[model samples]
Target chain A: MSEFLVLVVPMWVVFTLAAQGTILSGRTGVFNVTQEGVMALGASVGFLVSYKMGSNLVGLLIAFLVGALVGLVLAYMTTQLRLDQFVVGLALFFATTGAAGLLYRQVIGVTMTPPRVDTLPKFEIPLLGDLPLIGDALFVQDYVFYFAVILSLVMFWFLQHTSAGLDFRSVGENPKAADSLGINVTWARTWSTVVGTGLVAVGGAYIPLPFTGIYTDGMIAGRGWLVIALAFLGGWRPLYVVAGAAFFAAMDVLGQKAQVLGLGIPHQFIEMLPFVATLLVMVFALRWARQPAHLGMNYDRESRLVG
Target chain B: MSTMQKSETGPGGSPPVAKPEARGPGILTNIAWTVVPYVASVVLAFFLGGLLIQLMGYNAVDALRAVLTSSFDTSFGMVETLHKWVPIVLCAYAFAIPLATGKFNIGAEGQMLLGATGGAAVGITFSDLPMVVLLPATLVAGVLAGALWAGIAALLLVRFRVNEILSTVLLNFVSFKLIDWVATRVWPDAGAGHPATTPVGDGARLPLLGSAPAMHSGVLLVLALAIFIAVAMRFTPTGFEMRAVGDNLRASMVNGVRTSRLAGAGLVIGGGLGGLAGAIDVAGVHGRMLEGMQSNFLILGIIVGLMARGSMLALPVVAFGIAVLEYGAGTMQLVSAVPVEMVLVIEALILLLLLLSDLVRDRLRSAR
Candidate 1:
């Protein structure tokens, strides 16, 4: 059980962080599909910077900043230019994927042996790490795992308990009304997109820091999309998203565990489980999922507001 | 979209009277607006791509010259471009069809893969059959496979209200795994080093267009499909309903259109076209199902679809432009030693620049 928790915790952190980012952006009426590509960019950049600087935090920070830069472009396209969020998100996705691949090749030339770096070391708390059942899994982790949990909690409080959070929700729910009430819908959207993508980049950083210890072309894989599913699964709420992440991550761990046990089933099927689970969950739970009212619609002040 | 049209139509089907002086831009300016800027954007993307290669230490002018000359300078290059144009155009239709009904189908990659797998399965299994029988059977199998793959998303949407976009994206991952399994476990090539299925039967092969460059006869099929779709869209009631659904779903629903059926048909047709692309690829070019061949086809298709912007007539032109860039990029890499990934970067850059320019143009127009 402890072993299982150890395997699942970091996955949960990364996924929930991404889900949290999606929720944040979605709450401000921008449904970002570029998370997948942006996360890839983060993973690639994180690995490169960390390898060069020999500092995990700096690398993660750079990755977050890169995500913010990309998010700025997205915000400009969706908010200022009033383009279709879906199409713009996809275009940005393609750009990031291409940019990440090109930059990686440029930074680390093609070789038979791919580069690797040391993963972030675990930090164990004194008495907390000594706990019998939950110590290593919960109390002992790298700074990222702790930071992810704390960030999720802070975001939960930020989105729910604060007046700013209420204003943010109001902007998402009805931007015109929020604008009339002086909420600065544009500002809300821009910040949410920029800052939200920063957290997403942190989620992406986990791919290199904990999971892989190296960057590969497909490192981010479908985790970004999975987080999107998780956001919807959680109904855009932080704690529920964490719970969804835990469940999804547990399934991921279970797949690995099954493979480790040398089960006769083809590893491909095991590899396929998470995506399949996502599809099933989306199909079953989507009807009841409480989506943001203006999720993918661009807010244009000049255009006649029509419901 | 229909709101503007409806308002212009006025009450009781009477058209609003046109004002002579209040008319919008002249036909020439409208044509320029539609054509010139896009042409310039493509040129700009090419120049930027050249700059990117130069920054990477290759001679930009030399690289760009080689790319242009090699890909479009000779008959062989044009044939190669045309060969590539088939699948790219088909996949563009695959993406655009469902998009016409306001549904996002990003599963063209998966559908194409499954379609190839199905085509290969049928071709390999029915190798003894005559050409006439086996070819159609293989094509039908591929189309069915693609439709069924997309049907999963369609079903989820119509029945359970699942977002098609998410479902299709997830299904793409699933299809990759499924294809890998099909290659390795289900139809493993006898003692092949890597996982792959047996080559398709000769009976299933598409006839070649010419001796040199070896373009497939499937180009004719593509032309036919495009014309048929254009005609149907222009003349048919079902097509009108699809446009209606696409323009405004709520209004279409109120007007008693079965939006669900339109959505289903559009997606299935799109999926079918994607599968046909795979079928043509295997039978016409590869003669077998190739692993990872589905790479970036969906993105390219989406790019073409987006550039076409719901106009079926514009698809071929946009697809041809992309095909030139793609084919040129390969030659450029080989000749100039630039990394082939630069093409993707160029493609992305082109899209971004195009969007920015369009936005700027719109802002300027509104200001005026």
Candidate 2:
């Protein structure tokens, strides 16, 4: 129905907007594909705190903070220990995934009921919301949507205009040059990933608090990795990244439409379209994308590669 | 990572550090040095693991005591450990072969899954066959499936210059969905009302070893495979060529070692062993291709491979260590009010410490 489209499209855009924040972090060279884990951690923490304090806002803040802390640990290993970034990221994934599943199981064992939450209600600006299609799409949404939109704008300004942004960019592009200039290359990566962690956790917290209204294992699934891929597809630009996310949102919302539209694919295969498309795009497009020269290198002041 | 930097190295501060001869040392000193770098790390991880148990408001000693006893004390526990270790050993050997040949294989899990599926299918389809005929066929089918799966990555790498790591991982996603399809559509087990194949018939079940607890002939096969890999790596011309290619591909090519063939051989053999592990798991543990049962199982293989350090001698020990950790985590969940997330936290800390310690060691050596 048109009503369903009216509802789904806008929410889909907001999800994409949130994913853009993740892509920005990737562009900044954090490479913390463990975003999914951070998100899950935030979801659990948010659920626990919101349940305890009866304050959804507080839960959101806690989720952001906790997710960042987990990122810091990841940053410590990847930045300081000089481990293989991919393996570190994968290990992070393993630990967090198992932890998330176990935590969910312990909390909701054998309980058939989806944990309930009084989700944040939607708000409408008095005048703009009155516009026929555009107004409703833009203005009438939950607090998370507006927050994400504002955050996107702020990030766009910050990444482009700030001195710290220049240092961060230098650290990503050429670590040797950054280090020669006395910029703490490790610190920049660590902080960017920390912020990335917070953003991802915010994404995760949305699930239990406002998105799904309950906790479930593998709920974020590979959306975290998708965010990483989406970042590259967006060319790490904020606006394009959001668009890329919306494209996925459309796929997500339309996933069930395969049956309705008689696309005649297995539900799983249809569901895989967005990810497969992204992977192919990434594989091909990656040949063209210029990476930060030190993208996943672990720098030890003492050790040098013979080559 | 926190080490003083003194970058100057020459007559003022060095002892002709550049020469190949300078790298050698007394036999005892060399052994001591290699052992020293790892000792602190392993000890630190073990200590921290204990500390975490204490931090969880439980007696660390009591928990570790139980774990140690469970892994070693009773014959039943010993058999359980060996039983659990067999698949892990095979999986590590499967991964380590290509890894030694300078290939990164993250698809061990997916390969194992296919092995399980393929072997189960063959076994179930031929359930009317004699036990001797059925069992070996199932395992062989698994090994072939694994090799064939890995062969895709190998073929692409050889022909198209595709990145094997990325391709293998992507293939994992494909395999997972394919698995889901199989569990849901092709081989639904009506009894469980869940995604899984029909229960494998008794003919496919592995024979237990002399009334030992869960110990099967698979462990003996694992031992034989370990000996085979170790001997191959140590003595064979094929292994020397593979090692030469790994050390320096261009140099080895110039020296007339066929790098391509070596790569193909390594990958095929690795995948075959991984397939064997999957087959063993199906025939020995689950008796059916069940969904969710193999989650994190491949990870155990990875951990074992890393800890093995390309040494087959180390594979059994690494596998045993992982089995102890896994069994401990399982036991803790069953017995205590402690959350199973504690196991995840412990594993995370262990990996974190492992990486951190290696970095620290490198830094310390440079400082010296």
Candidate 3:
């Protein structure tokens, strides 16, 4: 049971971080679907940089910066140029995916045996980790896990209570109104995009740095898309997004546990738990979910009409 | 919102010239406005791709030359290109149709997988049947399975108000596992080591067209379908309605068009074509359903559709262009040790440039 919790909790952290990024971008009126490809690039690039630098922390920082840079490009294209968000996002996804693969091949070369990295060290809290039942799952983990959870809380507080957060949400809800009120909608959305995508890259970097310690082409898998689903499931709220991530993560771990226990059911069906859960959650929970009014619209300050 | 229409370069941009008696220069200028930017984008992408290859310490020109000659120069390469063209063309059409009805059917990968699975399942099950019975049955099964998979998303969207984009994407993951189950457990080939179904009988196989470097006859089927789609979209009321709905959902609703129904039909047709692409791969190329045969067709098909800009006539040409890049990239990888994923880089660059070219086009028009 401890082993199961250990496996499940980290995934929750990774997914929570990703969902937070989605919410951030979505709040800024950019439906960034490039998460999957960005994560793939993050995994590959993060793994490569760490391997070369011999410092996991440095690799993660570089990964976050790279993601922010990509986000900057996406922001410029979508907001400044008045291009279609979905289309440009899709194009960015492809570009990042290809860039990752190309860079990997160029740097690593094709090898009969792929290389592996050491997982980030886990830190057990002094007293809190000694508690029964949930201690190990909650208190003992890599720094990234704590960062992910703390970041979510921070994001929730930052988005709800802060005046800057109100302005950000306003820019997303009605850019023209925000602009009329002296808010720079373009700057808010662009910064949100950069920060959100950077956070997403951290989630991506977590896959290789702390969780797997090895990078493969399929390392990111569909977790990036799952992050988007969870964000929607949480109604674009930070805390509920964490809960949604945890639910999907638990389902994923449970499926593996069922396979281990040989529960007489086909493992394939069990493997589908996360996706099915996402679908169910969306269908039932989305009724109460509120989206940014201009979630995927391109904003132009010169144009009086809402995009 | 309507009053804010500025000098934007996108779908709203119009020629600056006042109405004139001379229509010939106007049409030529319009054609140039569209064609020039697209051509420039494609050329830039190829040049950038070559530059990347050169930066990796390989001869960029050599790699590109190899791509051209290996995929189009020789008879074998030409035949292979045509063989590959069948699936690309079908998949692009699948994506294009959905876009026309304001649907983004990103589940082409899932639909294609189910199509292949359905084709192989029927083909192997009725191995004793004659060609006429077995072949058509397999194709029909493929089409139905693809449509049914897409229909799940459509139903969810229309009935429950679940977004089709999210539903379709979720359904793709489901289809991947479903196909895996079918290939590995349901009809695993007796002596085969990999996750694959038993081979289809000869009767279900598509006939070859030529002697040496023979291509499957599925190309003919795809061509006929393309022509039909072109005529339908160009001349028919149904196609016009789909386009109208795509243009403005609220306006179409106000105008009494059944937007939901059109959305469903677009998905069905799109998914069916995607399935047919997979079916052709099985019946024409592979002779059995194999795990991971879907490859990058979904993304490639979407890119092709986008490049075509909703023109049925332009779809095949774009698909061919993509096929060339894909095939050439493979050869480039072999010769220069460059990653074939570079094709994706080139495609994305082309798409981004094209999107930005609207700005460039507007600037040029204003200058004129």
TM-scores of chain A across the candidates, in order, are 0.96, 0.87, 0.96
Worst 10 residues of 1 chain B by lDDT: B7-16
Query: What is candidate 3's TM-score against the reference?
Result: 0.96
User: Over the stretch B98-152, how does candidate 2's per-residue lDDT look in tens digits?
Assistant: 8767676767777888899999898888888889889989999999999998898
lDDT of 2: 0.69
lDDT sort, best first: 3, 1, 2
| Clash count in backbone of candidate 3 | 0
Model 3 lDDT per residue over A1-307, tens place: 7777788888887788778988998887888888998888877888889888887888788888889988999899877777777778888988998988888888889899888778899899999998887889889988988888789889999899999999989887888889899998878888999988988887888887655687889777678888888887788889888878878889867765656767787777877777787887777875788788888887767665555
Supply the DockQ value of model 2: 0.30
Deviation in Å, model 1, residue A116 alpha carbon: 1.0
DockQ, structure candidate 1 = 0.50
Show where candidate 1 strays beyond 4 Å: A255-259, B1-26, B74-76, B366-368
- The lDDT for every candidate, in the order shown, is 0.82, 0.69, 0.82
Name model 3 segments beyond 4 Å from true: A255-259, A304-307, B1-25
Arrange candidates by TM-score, descending: 3, 1, 2
Please report the interface RMSD of model 2 to 1 decimal.
7.7
Please, what are the lDDT tens digits per residue for candidate 1 over residues A13-49? 8888888888999998888898898899888888889
Those runs of model 2 whose alpha carbons end farther than 4 Å from true positions after fitting are A1-25, A101-114, A125-139, A161-163, A253-265, A286-288, A300-307, B1-24, B36-39, B101-103, B131-133, B151-167, B201-203, B212-214, B236-269, B363-368
